[model samples]
Target: MIRTIVGLIIVLALSVVVISSVPDYSLPSGLQGVGQDYTERGVNDTGSVNLVTAVVVAYRGLDTLGEVVVLFSASTAVVLVLTLVPMGANPTPSSSIVAFTSGVLPGSIVLFGIYIITHGHLSPGGGFPGGAVVASAFLLVMLGSNKIPGKSKLLASIESLAGVTFGLLGFWGMMMFGQFLNNMVLPAGSPGKLFSAGIIPLISLVIGAKVASELSGVFSSYRKAGGDE
Candidate 1:
């Protein structure tokens, strides 16, 4: 315990030291430049209404790749935990009130999540937030509907497919554009159209599907283990 505590302290100290040593810049000025440049590029080059999506999926696709890695890591960690500690079956029947509420909630969440992901190029919501919302819906279902057990294998398969697709798409981009995640090959559809922004919508859908599946798997395992009690 002492060694563990010391290690944690050292890690925390290092993090603080690193953060403190970082150079500070005029954040507002930087943001203004970013926004102006993004807007100009969005109109002139991509013609996409959603500058943020253009940035995330095209201009800075590499960052999105890193974000996917983080999600994959989280899913892997959850799977490891579930495998090491077997969860038991559900202990109690879900209350009627909880069931009714949960039933209504998931539909609304699904709708909202879809909207968020689909309109990501036009609004603030994007793949990650949309995915998390879908995951929350799955969590609610797991909590309130014990009768409908989630399929772990199916969820795992979906997660794997999404991850694989993302990687393959990145590789394809590299082959076409000489950069691993460049969106240059994608048809820059008319800016505000639903199909615009090359691979942004597709990537968002993949991320959402993966996150939802992995989260459902995690929740299902916990529910089975009787952890909900």
Candidate 2:
């Protein structure tokens, strides 16, 4: 009862904060400054119908790169810490229902994640969410499988290569266009298509792969630390 009351208080407090902030968020009378520029030219500039993708992968690419680097660093730190510690107690065995669901669900979830990454330039979802979805599928597999899952070495290799490729692509854009992650380095195709948006889709896919690999490695390390074989 105390725990429930505390939870309700926390929720109510957050709700009050959010509701209080709502009045401060009046709709803009008109798009202005960078907002105006992006709305006016994002499609023509990056060939991504999804202006959010254009901003994330083209205009503000460096921010995304920094975020990925932070994620990688944090995962690496956790992995190293785990390596130094003694192995923890073995994990409890999964129930039959969990094992069955893990077996049946991961493959489809992975495919859907790939779809989300590939279509990011045309849709709402992108590399970050796609990668998280894939990682969650791996997490489910680990939680439900009889054995601790994920290949550590393979995940590391993939993660390293994807990180390198991401940097190399940024350099490539710089070489050609005097800017990092320049979307115009390659020809931008027709919008709302599978193979458009120059390097945005490619970078998005790379980000997804790197993020998935990094998270999978972290998950594997955690499970291994629990003395799972």
**Native-to-model Cα distance after best TM-score fit, residue 114 in candidate 2, in Å:** 0.5
- 188, model 1: CA deviation in Å? 1.0
Quality of model 2 by C-alpha lDDT = 0.89
Candidate 2's clash total is 0
Best TM-score among the predictions, by candidate number? 2
Assess each prediction's global lDDT (C-alpha) against the native.
Answer: 0.77, 0.89
lDDT for model 1, on a 0 to 1 scale? 0.77
Candidate 1 residue-wise lDDT, 66-158, digit = tens:
887887798688767876776565657778998898988899998898888887877788777888888888788777866536455778788
State in Å the error of residue 193, model 1. Answer: 0.9
| Candidate 2 lowest-lDDT run of ten | 145-154
Candidate 1 ranges with C-alpha deviation above 4 Å? 1-35, 147-151
Instruction: Provide C-alpha RMSD values for all models, in order.
Output: 5.1, 3.2
Show the lowest summed lDDT stretch of 10 residues, model 1. Answer: 25-34
- Candidate 2, 119: how far from true, in Å? 0.8
